[model samples]
Target chain A: MNIKVAFLAILLMALITYIPRVLPLAIFRKEIKSKYIKSFLQYVPYAVLGSLTFPDILYSTGALTTAVCGTVVALILAYFEKGLVIVALGAIITVYAAGFIL
Target chain B: MKKNFLYGLKRGIPIALGYIPVSFTFGLMAVTGGMPVWMAIFISMSNLTSAGQFAGTYLILHGAGLLEITMTTFVINIRYMLMSLSLTQKLSQDMTLPRRMLIAFGVTDETFTVASMEHGSLSFFYLLGLITGPFIGWSVGTALGAFICSSLPEALSNAMGIALYGMFIAIIIPPAKKSMPVIFIIVISVLVVCILRYIPLFSSISSGFRVIISTIIGAGLGALLFPFEARDNNIQEMRE
Candidate 1:
């Protein structure tokens, strides 16, 4: 790809990404008043995060077995209220261990 | 002001740690796709999105037209609009227009989750602090990954690849455990995503649309099935 084309593409990508994010904040200046809308918004974070993690997490590791191991370890650590980094580290270490063992 | 910023920075550390390996992979992929190190870093800095950047870079490398790249990014990143709109429910009036715009630019999935989870209204400085750590981690990790693409062992990198999702799991589990509705929402959302991913016909739907559809259905179902009681103190209070 031409250097200028690549650079322009990056700039364009940035613009598109920025527009979606900023437009909502700009237009929805008033607090959302509808109870149902508010309730739906309340659930958006969890739903989005949940969808992002599953199935995708399974494919993140080198093998599905190791990914499951990592996920189990992560769930345990997170259940114990371990910090985010600790949970991530626990999962990564477990995956590496799974890799070595298998 | 400094205190809020510092607190947000502290909260941002784990997110920053989570971002490094993933951004590193993105950098590695970009270079392997024939992009220069600077170009790869530039993309990370300009666009903090993960999937959008990966897909955009793939299209760019394949010599896709500018319209294709823009539309692809728009579809992948449309979720941010929902996230940002939700966040507006929590923004203080003191958070001016300019500041909101700045904060909006940094609203990645991780940042949105973290910020929305806060109990009270958000501050501009706090949002800045929250975004800065991950911003640096993402950009710097790209630089490192681009520079050391050949040297990093595959096993170690693969191990690190799990960290970002692990972070996502960490974010959702506590809340899910606390609330029955949250648990249901998460389970349904996951199921929705899985069906879309594994079922032959649904699997063909573009990933961007899959997430949008899943989030809408999951959240809509949750809202319908378990409407919040009007008596419970609303969680969306904005600080003056």
Candidate 2:
């Protein structure tokens, strides 16, 4: 990529990305009154997290077996209510070890 | 305000740690693919996005037009609108327009998740502090990867791939375990993602759109099936 072209592309990408993030926060100043909407907003985080994790996590380590091993370790640690760092490190370590084993 | 800011900074440590490997990978990919190191760092610093930056950089490397890059980034990042909207309900009353705009820039999936899980309304300082660490981590990690490409062992870098997802699991699973509605939301979302991901008919849908669609269905069904009580929905009351 030419430096000039890359700069334009990066600027365009940044602008497009920033617009979605800024628009909602800019436009919706008042609290939404609808219970349905509120409930939906409340659940959005979990839904997004859930959706982002599966299928994607399975492919994160580039191998199905290692990814599954990492995921199971993460799930178990998370199930046991481990801290964020612990669950993450556990999964990483598991994937590394499993990569060696399998 | 200072206390909240520091608390948020402390809370952001894990998220910052999680971002390092991912951004490092991004840096590695961009540089390895012939993108200038400074450009990779600039993208990380300016965009602060994972998927969008990767896709945009890929297209740029392949000599895609500005329009294509713009459209692709817009599609990938459209999910942030939902996150920002959801956050509108959580913002503290003191949030002004400038502050809101600044905070909005930091609303990545991980930051949004952590912020949304807070017990009460979000203050600007807290949100600012929350964003600071991850921002630094992302840029610094990218710089390292760009400068030190191929030096890190493959095994370690590959293993680090699961760290962010593991952090996501850590965020959602504990709450899901306690609440039936949360479990339903998670299960539905996961199921929706699986369907879109595996079904041949849905293969054409991009990954970014897949996340947005799954989120809407899962959260919409959850809202219908388990509406919050007036007490729970009342943000003002909770703030007090």
DockQ for all models = 0.47, 0.51
Give the range where candidate 2 chain B is weakest over 10 consecutive residues by summed lDDT. B231-240
Count of backbone collisions in candidate 2: 0
The ten-residue window of minimal lDDT in model 1 chain B covers B231-240
Off by over 4 Å in 1: A1-13, A24-28, B1-40, B48-150, B201-203, B229-240
Pairs in steric clash, model 1: none
Q: What is the interface RMSD of each candidate, in Å?
A: 5.5, 5.8
- Give one digit per residue, the lDDT tens place, for model 1 in B133-184: 9999999988987888656577666686677677677767777677888899
lDDT of 1 by residue, A53-96 (tens): 78877877769999999999999998886755678779988999
- Score chain A of each prediction against the true chain A by TM-score and list the results: 0.72, 0.71
Cα-lDDT of candidate 1: 0.78
TM-score of 2: 0.63
| Alpha-carbon runs more than 4 Å astray in model 2 | A1-17, A24-29, B1-44, B47-150, B230-240
TM of each candidate vs. truth: 0.64, 0.63
Q: How many residue pairs clash in each candidate?
A: 0, 0
Q: What is the docking quality class of candidate 1?
A: acceptable
